[model samples]
Structure formats: C-alpha cells, structure tokens
Target: MKILVTGGAGFIGSAVVRHIIKNTQDEVVNVDKLTYAGNLESLVEVSDNVRYAFEHADICDKEAMERIFAEHKPDAVMHLAAESHVDRSITGPAAFIETNIVGTYVLLEAARAYWSGLNEAEKSSFRFHHISTDEVYGDLPHPDEHPASAELPLFTEKTAYAPSSPYSASKASSDHLVRAWLRTYGFPTIVTNCSNNYGPFHFPEKLIPLVILNALDGKALPIYGKGDQIRDWLYVEDHARALYTVMTKGKPGETYNIG
Candidate 1:
C-alpha cells in the first residue's frame, strides 16, 4: 500500500513514517511544510529507503494537496499536520485555526475530489485517518489531587468535548470536520485520539523532553506548581504501531482511542 502521511517530519509523524518504511513492505509519501515543529533530520534513517518519498507541502494549500493526491495515488492518508503546542496556541491562535481547522477542511475537500475519481476497488479500499488528541475531551482533575484509589478520573470515548485551550479546540474542530465528511459524503474516514507521546525525536517544547534536556545540561528541572500533574503518556514507537493498525484494519467511520 502507498500511504500519504501529512506532517511526516514532526515528532509523532516521523515515527509513523519510519515505522512504515523500516518494518512494512508498504510505501509512504511524506508531506510536510517544514514548520518549526517538524524536523527532516528525524527521518534521516528512512530517507534513503526505496519505499519512502517526501513532498514539501502544506495541508492548507488546496492545489498542493490535490496535486499530491493525484501524484501519489496513495491507498490511504494519515493526517498528522497541525499547530499542536498549547502555549503557542494560547499566544497565537491564528496559526492553529488556519492549520488545524481550515487546513483540515482543505485537505478533506481535496481528498474527496480525488476519491471521487478512483476506481471501484481503489475507492472501496481507501481510508482517510485523522490523528487527534485526547485533549479535546479536556482536562480532568489532576489524579494526584484525588485520593489514590478514587476511580482515577479518566476520559473515555463517551466523554464530552470541552476543549480548554485553543490548541485542543482547533483539534476538536478538525475531528468534527472529519466525522462530518464521513456522515455527509460517505467518505471512508476514521479518527483516533491519543494520549501524550514521548520518545526519540520529541521536541523540547514538551515537558518530558524539556526536563530531560535541562537536567542533562545541569539546569534545574522546570516543574509546574507542586509537581504533581499526572499526565498519561505512551512511547512514540508504540503509538506509531497503533496508528498503522487502525489505518489498516480499522472499520471506516469508527473512532478509536489510542495510548
């Protein structure tokens, strides 16, 4: 299968690209706009693979998305592109709104147009998987603040959307768009919401990486008040594997929570 992965140079996206290139016989076309969050250096290991390709493009560009879809003729598309930093979004939400909300809209339309012209077999097999965050469900009371065994306050698939930050709100909008396309146009779209991820290539804006780097550099670890936030996290490689499973074996129009 030939998969087109948007934001394929970013942390989690790079892991997905490397996983497919190193482990599977399937091909990957990486589309990224080379934002500060994205680093092509992370993909160096798989850059030379026969089944890997790269396209420097933004998801917000309709023409570029359409052209990419036409050129790659991919069997699937995994959308991981977005302005994902909460602090950045709070300081400047325009980028988040543009890339996460408007960008998703453009990509969906472009993908719909491409899918409309596919042969029966290709259309039936095609999938558009939107990668999202658990943050859209919003925050729960910090588990550390609660009693050790007081049910652990978790957000399940049935949780209501209450995005507290611009970042989460934009992602929530994109998730809604994907589902709307699935219902209104019968687009073969799937969605996945995942917990925070950490592993190799994680940029330092994230707490874990920031603390690790600061500690290694002999600086004090920066911890927020009381240092008691209990955030769920998963390894990047594990997340990559789960994404591939959902893309390959998941049913269309279904949503999965991965961690």
Candidate 2:
C-alpha cells in the first residue's frame, strides 16, 4: 500500500514513518512543512529507502494536497500536521487555529475528492486516519485533587470532549471535522487520541526532552504548577505501531484511545 503521512518529520510521525518503512512493504510519501518541531534528521535512518519519499508542503494548501493525492495515488492518509504546543497555543492561537482546524479541513476535502474518484475497490480499501492528542478529553482527576483510595479516571474511547487549552480545543475541532466527514460525506475516517509520547528525536521543548537536556546541562528542571499532575506516557515506537494497527485494521468512524 502507498501511505501519505503528514508531519512525518516530527518526532512521533518520524517514528511512525520508520516503523512502516522498516517493518512493512508499504510505500510512504512524507508531507511536512518543516516546522520548528519537525526535524528531518529524525528520519535519516529510513530516508534512503526506495519506498520513502518526502514532500515539503503545508497541509493547509489545498492545491498542493490535491496535486499530491493525484500524483501519489495513496491508499491511506495519516494526518498528523498541527501546532501542538500548549505554551505556544496560549501565547499565539492563530497558528493553532490555522494549522489544526483549517488545515484539517483542507486535507479532508482533498482526501474526499480523491476518494470519490477512486474505483469501488480502491475506495473501499482506502482509510483516512486522523491522529490526535488525549488532551482533548481534558484533565483527568489529578492525584493532587483526589484521595489515594479514590479510583482515578482513564481516558476511554467514549470520553467526552472537554478541552482546556487552545491546543486541545483546536485538536478537538479537527477530531469533530474528521467524524463529520465520515457521517456527512461517508468518508472512511478513523480517529485515534493518544496520551503523552516520549522517546528519541523528541523536540527539546517537550517535558521529557527538556528535562533530560536541561539536566545534562546542569540546569534545574522546570515543573509546572505543583508538579503532581499525573500523565500516561507512551513510547514513540509503541505509539507508532498502535497507529499502524488502527489505520490498517480499525473500523471506519471508530475512535481509538491509545496510551
């Protein structure tokens, strides 16, 4: 299969690209706008593979996306392009709105048009998987707010959308757009909301990477609030495998919660 992966130069996306290129026979077309968080060095291992190709383009460009769909004829799409940092979103929300909401709309429309033109067999086999963060479910009961004996809530597939930050809100909006495309247009779309991911090639701004790099430099680690917030952390490689499984085997219109 030929899969087109947006944000493939980002940390988690790079892991997904590597997993697919190394473990499967599928071909990959990596589409990334080369944002600050997206580093091509992360994909150096699989960049030389014949099945791997790269496109330096933003998801918001409808003409570029249409051209890509026509040229690559991808069998599946893994949408991961977005402005994901909470601090950045809080300080400047326009980028998040532009990328997460409008960008998703552009990509969805392009995919819909391409799928509409495909033959029945090809159409039925195609999948559009939207990757999202678990932050859309909002904050779970933190350990600081609950008793030790009390049962803590985990984000399930049925969790309600209660985004607290601009980043999460934009992602929630994109998630809704994906499902709307499935319900209103009969698009074969799947959504996966994953927990915090930490592993190699992670950008330095993220908590784990920041802490490690800062500690290495003999600097104090910065912890937000009281530092008691609990989070589920998934390794990037594991998250990549889970995403591949959902994209290939998951049912359309289904939302999977991965941690």
lDDT of 2 at 148: 83
Assess every candidate by TM-score: 0.97, 0.98
Score residue 162 of candidate 1 by CA lDDT: 96
* Deviation (Å) of 155 in candidate 1: 1.6
Candidate 1, 81-182: lDDT as tens digits: 999899999999999999999999999999999999999999989999999999999888866578986787778778999999999999999999999999
- Candidate 2 runs further than 4 Å off: 147-150
Tell me how far the alpha carbon of residue 85 in candidate 2 is from the true structure, in angstroms, after superposition: 0.8
> Which stretches of candidate 1 lie above 4 Å from their native place?
144-150
- Model 1, residue 226: displacement in angstroms? 3.1
Per-residue CA lDDT of model 2 for 1-259, tens digit only, reads: 9999999999889999999999999999999999898999999999999999999999999999999999999999999888989999999999999999999999999999999999999999999999999999998876667788878768898988999999999999999999999999999999999999999998889999899999999999999998877789999999999999999999999999998
